[model samples]
Target: MLDYLKKSFARKKARRQFQEYSHTVSKFILKEEGEIAFANWNNPLVTPKVISQEEVNFFKKFIPKGALCIDIGTNIGDTTVPMALAAGKTGTTIGFDPNPHVYKILEENVKLNRDKTNIAPFPYAITKDEGEFYYHSSEASFGNGGISNEIVSDQGAFQLPQKITGINLEKFLEKNYRALLPKLSFIKVDVEGADKEVIGSIGNLLTKYKPVLVAECFTRATSEERAELYNIVADLDYTLYYFSDFDENAEIIKLEGPKDMNRWKTFNFYAIANAE
Candidate 1:
């Protein structure tokens, strides 16, 4: 074991090198079950990105330990696993992902971390309703983590069979708000370009739970479409916080007036919650 660890850490290479030996990486994490599961770009389905120190601390402050956390784009359980750890044995984590390739690896990581008991894995995409959609599979395309491009497959972005788990977030809240609500802590949404739909579905919960929302906004979206989304959240009365990357400190950003409608290429994340 000592020798293996030494060898694995001795030679450092490009991030993609781990992709060649994904199985090996899987084995390493799987060897110790119940330990915190962590993954990187090698996983392909979910790649770990550097989050800002302030953001980490923010979660520490607001995301209570042993609170139920929901991960929308679980990918490979990067945030899901940590959420489980943060919640501890008493807490529960629910992860949702539609990509079969990513879901398989997410389950593997869940087992690798021995979080199967604490985390419930859902293999489906969270959309406004149940319906068919297309996804892109690209090894080269970076960013726009969710379904950014059109359903059309090109440049190796194949349109695989996908079904949206028509989840009326409001209804889910009405059903589980009392029975399963866990302090209703942190919520992360990075579903490519479907942010509008996902948020729309959770209209009531956003108001009831009032959890800190980490949402990714597609800057390239049409001016009108962006305005609609901004208005939806505005009506909810959430203070917007911007996070370009996880590691930087979150800054308060004012939303444009109801009439200001302009399109930008920068994707901004808003950390919205009650003022007090």
Candidate 2:
């Protein structure tokens, strides 16, 4: 009876915490310009700290008007919306988020901007192979949710585990998006620590379409893992550029070597297939 009471108390506390977080998120959203909705109240992206204005400007500069783009980790349409708007009516933007909990919000955000942004949201995790995988749902922050393939214990909030479908990027593209492959212009990938796997899965497409890739490189990744990821893009003859901070006027430094990158906990960088 005592144990039961303890569990009940814990549950109540958690509920209260969640409620407070939700209210804070709502307040934050009210200040934003766009009609952005979030399924998870604790989603880090809901806070302005997560989305930087410079990052938005960088994406806008690269993702041309009327271009087909892919947002690997849409995260409630923060970057996806801008990509869609930049793509314009003649272009298409496909956003993917495996987290079912947050996917609903992604869909809602896309719908909210339907008239202005041509963005499609898919709730499937992209992987090197097509199969089932456990996705660690983070109770603390939406940004921390990641695949179970690698032991990601640091997933914030550490919520219940969920089984998510992993789609093979190459196969999915060939089967359904083959016609749109050649038209692919940009791909923004921010799949937590699964950056290598995500990039590897789309190796063929990277070579064929040569779309500009914007990937998040987590400092937690081992030097070897980073090297392999760098080689993957380098082998395909892509030039690397790094965005060390959120300064809009900051120059996108050309990464000549691995040592060039500022080892921030998580940093966004770009890889252009063909560069002068």
Candidate 3:
């Protein structure tokens, strides 16, 4: 164990030798898991270990092999990669994140699996409205956030701003991936506070395909807004499930409706369509 740790640290130190990005990117590889590149490697969202068998299996429950999946707010492809694997090589996993720093790494991670996993990443936010989108991040895309309408922030300090292109995923998919709509099996959304907006925008898809959904109920949002977020899914006839943290063995809690949120403070959850 001691020798393995020493060699592991040595390899990590060696990999950091060529951080060729303004945000200082690093490459980390977990023996069999392949390579993962990230700006803030410590951020749980980009860590390689987060894609354990349990995580992949969790997604496997909702995602069939050769089915289509989507990951919104996919910072640097950690969750995206797992979903891709669960969907198998023939399937496609699409990830969207407007933060360039992390999106670059997201692209790199996708390339690492070019021969094995089918992942297509886009640098557009899944917004409902039509407007100029601006992404501001103090932590260089390591944490949660969205390409919001405003460029300025009252949150204070180091909010590096970048203009981002926005698109409605439902409309975009209807136009581009129209034929693949039947294969749409899952949609994961964790855009900090804009989870509701993304959920609301895909109302048509949710009603038509009724794919399993994973979304977050952010603490920053008002109770009314949170209720509406769940209501959107509930009204679409999907059962809701949540886990407080992304533990490998995390057990999901089922929510009958928005009121169940008061008892379990988990921000993230899975929503499956109800049977006919």
The candidate that achieves the highest lDDT relative to the unseen native structure:
3
- Rank the candidate models, highest lDDT first: 3, 2, 1
Model 3 clashing-pair count: 0
Candidate 1 has what TM-score? Answer: 0.70
Tens-place lDDT digits, model 2, residues 158-202:
543457788887787678777777788899898887887888889
TM-score of 2: 0.78
Clashing pairs in 1: 51-246, 51-247, 52-246, 52-247, 52-248, 66-87, 129-166, 130-166, 146-191, 146-192
Regions of candidate 2 where Cα sits further than 4 Å from its true position: 1-57, 137-143, 149-161, 245-248, 262-265
Off by over 4 Å in 3: 1-49, 138-143, 244-249
lDDT of 3: 0.73
Candidates in order, TM-scores: namely 0.70, 0.78, 0.80
lDDT of 1 by residue, 205-274 (tens): 7777787777766655677776776777777887655444543355545555433334336455565665
Error of 3 at 186 (Å): 0.3
